[model samples]
Target: MSKQFDLSVMDGMDRREVREYVSSLLWQLRLCDGFWFLNVEKRHGRAEAEAVNGLVWDKMGDLAARDVLERFGPFADTPCGFWKAYEYLPWIPTVECAVEHDAPDAEGVIRGITVTVRRCPAQAGREKHGLEPYECREMHETEFRRFAARVSPSVQVECVQAPPDPTPPEYDCRWRFVLPVGAGGDR
Candidate 1:
């Protein structure tokens, strides 16, 4: 049996022309990397976290290997640059929830960007399914770090808070991105 693939499969945008649409598309845009992960989780449930995360890594790693980001990414391999570039991505922040960023922690002990996601759409969706929001901290740590490395190997990421942890009412998750002194990052 053969399978049929339809252009309408793409979130309702009828892609009537394949060649020109692809030619004009920015393949390394980075938004799909996030959307794919969420869609898999939504369709398969939280148990899919590990699998979806691994797949995201595989896809993202391939981008790194392709030298793809150089053509489209605005990130500069610096903490500030990562946040600035990431914040501008249109759908990710909108789909996930508005993210709040704090650059350079108050003590100045780390020159990095601290990000907060107050209302994660994924978590809300899972909760609606009567499923406990699965743990995503570890998976996201790998995914985000790999994503940053694709832009600039010097960028580092840590998930300060994620699901399965008691998310404070103010935020659902928090992440910190840093460029250590040795990595040509600000001291």
Candidate 2:
């Protein structure tokens, strides 16, 4: 299989066609077991987005190697883009979830409990009265720990970082915690 494979073989192919082909291939490979979800994020531009969509189509055969059913992306609007590609390959069961962070901390078991809070910058004159967008900056962390305490002692807390944006350096930090899969009592 390695000898017959060429990573760059799809460079000249129309992206929509390539995506359809890959979707078909992944469906056949599923063997009626397991699920696949492709998550596409908001893209910055059309060309770069198309390139990533094409790249996903080009790399579909390698999904088994990556051990992930979902492909996260900032995809394009072409027919072979993430949404259409997923629709074409509906047999594989795809899901779209917001991509919270580039790296998620899952060092231990997950309990399925997550808490998120947004912190915003204080206006120039608001500092004197201590008025801020959020009541407590450490609220997320405190809530995470409180949720963890309710879970079984055997379960471990999984800390996942929230997405970061450079817009507000002083006030835009978000935090999340994933509880052990079944420990938190919900999906």
Candidate 3:
């Protein structure tokens, strides 16, 4: 059993700091399965405040996979297809980071950062609930990416597959994301 926290309440912090904070919180809560989605709101001077979900933060991990969720805070309320019907997953605190980007077309834009934490799928499923093997497997390799043509624009994020599993259907995987981080908007 782990205690859950919200990101909406955490303001005035950078991403790395946030990650350290959340890591401490998770370690304290004894939570093995959880994830945080960081939603950054860009404003004058810098990106302003945002919100987070406590329940949604807890159920995004697999032993065979890395349980990291990016770009989630802003869309906490939005309906997500992946996390539709799971319970006991606690949402935890998130960290914010200032990203510096420099591209050919665009330069000197500030981007807010967010990181989500969770347990590996298999362990999470077995300990919290009896999840099917296939479901846990799907979560392991699923790649999530968001792209926009305007505003901050065109960021690609995904979970990279790990080495193939020797065990019949099991697979190894890793999470990866490529977003335009600096002055350049998108390249």
Against the true structure, what is each candidate's TM-score?
0.61, 0.22, 0.26
Once fitted onto the true fold, the runs of candidate 1 whose alpha carbons sit more than 4 angstroms away are 1-49, 61-68, 88-91, 96-110
lDDT of 2 by residue, 1-187 (tens): 3455675766787989788777776656542321111122133443443345445444542342122223333222211222222333433233222223223235432223332223322222234445332222233334333323322222233434432223243333434333333332211
- Residues 1-64 of candidate 3: C-alpha lDDT, one tens digit per residue: 1134456545787888787776787665543332221122123211121122211222323310
TM-score of 2: 0.22
Query: Model 1 TM-score?
Result: 0.61
Q: Rank the candidates by lDDT, best first.
A: 1, 2, 3
Best by TM-score: 1
Candidate 3 stretches with Cα past 4 Å from truth are 1-118, 121-123, 127-132, 136-143, 146-152, 162-173, 180-187
Clashes of each: 0, 8, 42
- RMSD (Cα, Å) for all candidates, in order, is 8.2, 18.4, 15.9
Off by over 4 Å in 2: 1-4, 7-11, 32-187
lDDT of 1 at 116: 78
Best model per lDDT: 1
Tell me model 2's lDDT, rounded to 2 decimals: 0.34
State in Å the error of residue 109, model 1: 13
